[model samples]
Target: MSTGFDREQGEFARGARAAVVYPDLGGSSRDADARLEETAGLALAIGIQVEDRLAFRLRQPKPGTLIGSGQVETLAEAVRDQELQLVVFDASLSAVQQRNLEGALGCKVIDRTGLILEIFGERARTAEGRLQVELAHLDYQAGRLVRSWTHLERQRGGFGFLGGPGETQIEADRRLIRDRMARLRKDLEQVSRTRSLHRERRQRAPWPVIALVGYTNAGKSTLFNRLTGSDVMAENLLFATLDPTLRQIALPGIDKAILSDTVGFVSELPTQLVAAFKATLEEVITADLLIHVRDVSHPDSEAQRDDVEAVLADIGVAETTPRIEAWNKIDLLDEERRAALSAETAQRDGVMAVSAATGQGIEALRTMMAQRLTAGHRRFVVRLDPSDGAGAAWLHQHGEVLDHWVEDDAAFYEIRMAAQDHDRFLARQDR
Candidate 1:
């Protein structure tokens, strides 16, 4: 038997042989380093095992290679030596740059957008999600109409006799993709309508909805699963949970309210992705409360927070929507930093620090959410006739009755409730 696998492996090797490259045009070296690491993480998520990385401090991007001629030659040699099957660029690349890089390196080249699209294509679970990913992919490939259609030379239809169609294979493929996109759009619209109807029904229920949103892999899903006792997919990978999962969280005081975990936002999330996944993100827009979770231990946590907020604003969730900020992943922080963060943000009403993984400060978060839910309630002390079962039933259904004392002639009650429900309570008592 052979001792170990050789570096020169088959094209269909189980592990990907990949490399990362970035053009250092501007920004701090620390930022560039972080981006390279993040890109490597993204590549790994897309089933690519990054074998090596190359960074060039180019003052400006070359139109063809993005890393200049000299750097391209060096990178090509490295790719040959390492036997890389694919190359990933940290920054977004134009169609020309992508084609040139692939030709020069003699391997498949992917930019940040393409890599992200590939991950989405692989991770999408629901029919709507799959359709959305396909739409994005078609839109992306449409722009790069280069060599992908070179295999349609001898294709024919029917019983394998001869060529049949007037249109080329490329044209026919484009038409088929367009038709599928049209059908997907119609289906997505129907899904949207159904979701709206479900939302309307939930409005009539006695629950306030709280949505958790943050950057990818920022522990939003973990917090969601912890709070709701759900077994939703929570992994260390990006976009682990694409479909929004809503679960009923029983807060201590307010026994039943919906807590929805929405898809994470990212910096420069493809515009096509936003357009296609609007159905999934509707949870964020319709939420009564938005919980913004941030990874406090991250070096760029504040910037990530701003990115999430920007996406929220774009989706119309930033206009007067009540939002609470959760400084998550506190378990990763040291004592000094934790104390510093706590002291800095302590006075803010909507800000709280917690660890989703270790279940730290979760009870306080639940209490805070309950307090927000009950903020508008007015304490009501009402005296009703003891035999009036109808009034008691109305109160029980419409509002939370704190306590009541049974008397011979009437019932003494203390209630904390919504103003609208309080009005209804008075009307039923009068009746």
Candidate 2:
């Protein structure tokens, strides 16, 4: 599960039995069992079967094993009795702790960061996605490489004791990793530049870009597909969508708007990933609006929402950016509870209750999106020269033309246009 521990290529074969362990340190906003359940889902996403799942209560962390000795012994017994090939810990582990835990447990061990990195590596489809994953994996591996090494002996080089091994194998490996990471970053910078160019062109195209963001497996892709009619892969698996997807859709009273379906955010997402995927997530950072599709029926929905908000804040998404909380998956709720939730959401200004699966409240959601996106528009009545086809076309493309007619060989248009577009139109008329 650890990225750098992939020396045995097929050691983590599909369907390998594994146990998930979550350290319940207490005072968490979310339940420990839910964390364990999420870890199991992540393991299953990569075809690993979770044979057992447990949350160990720990008031203090042990440097050697993270959990206490007795807890380690109990976990070891489970691994031995079940013949589990792997155990996943739903907490960040130090390199030393990971090494010692594996030694004590007598099996492969991975922590929350490593498990998430594994999922990102498995689900990354595009070349850019693959590169980002590799960069993050290298960053993680570089930190642990020294502690992961078995041989600490100096490789004798140059004249006897004078040189005393200029560089050890572990150091050499780390240098190589650093060099590879540099190259990947350079490549990603190029990708970022290309994406920037595309983004600039989209801005010039003058279409509003709306981004879909939420916790992993929170029905974002389903809502995106429902909105855009694009067949993006939407499954129940965690991290199902790694690459960002975009499609153009028409909204109520809006001709064209770009909708971006982004990779889902997860709790304790690897910081390495956040840094590496910043280029891709720039779309969300620059989005005109964000639609946070949440699994309202999930037990930890509020905590998950907070997790998503934290990631957005980490990525520097502006608090002023307009957001709509799409309380999704209401179909999973019982009728009475769903009704109460619907009523509550109706009273909230920026919230909507929706079931993307059943097509409920989707139209209302669209209307709300249109209203939010066009909230700054002002009505205008502009007259153009009879031969000014370009001016008429520009107005239609950039604004919602409510009515148009020709009288005295002049075309008059009544439109709802943004303040900036209205200014640009006046400038064009003066030109």
Q: How many steric overlaps are in each model, in order?
A: 0, 0
**Cα-based TM-score, every candidate:** 0.85, 0.91
In candidate 1, where is summed lDDT lowest over 10 consecutive residues?
154-163
lDDT of each structure?
Answer: 0.76, 0.85
Compared with the true structure, what per-residue lDDT tens digits does model 2 show for residues 1-431? 23212333213345667899999988888888888889999888876789999889998999888899999999999999998878889999998998788788777787888778777876787889988987887787777763333122323211100112232334437777777788999999999999999999998878999999999999999999999888999998899999999999999888899999999999989999999999999999999999999999999999999999999999999999999999999999998999899789878898999999999999999999998999889999999997988988899888889998999988899999899989888998897
Across residues 177-294, which tens digit of lDDT does each residue of candidate 1 receive?
5776688788889989988988999876657889999999899999998898898999998888787888987775665789998778877788778888888888889887888999
Model 2 — which ten-residue stretch has the worst lDDT?
A: 156-165
Which pairs clash in model 1? Answer: none
Off by over 4 Å in 1: 1-14, 27-30, 149-173, 380-398, 403-413, 420-431
Which residues of candidate 2, in runs, are more than 4 Å off? 1-10, 146-172, 405-409
In terms of lDDT, model 2 sits at 0.85
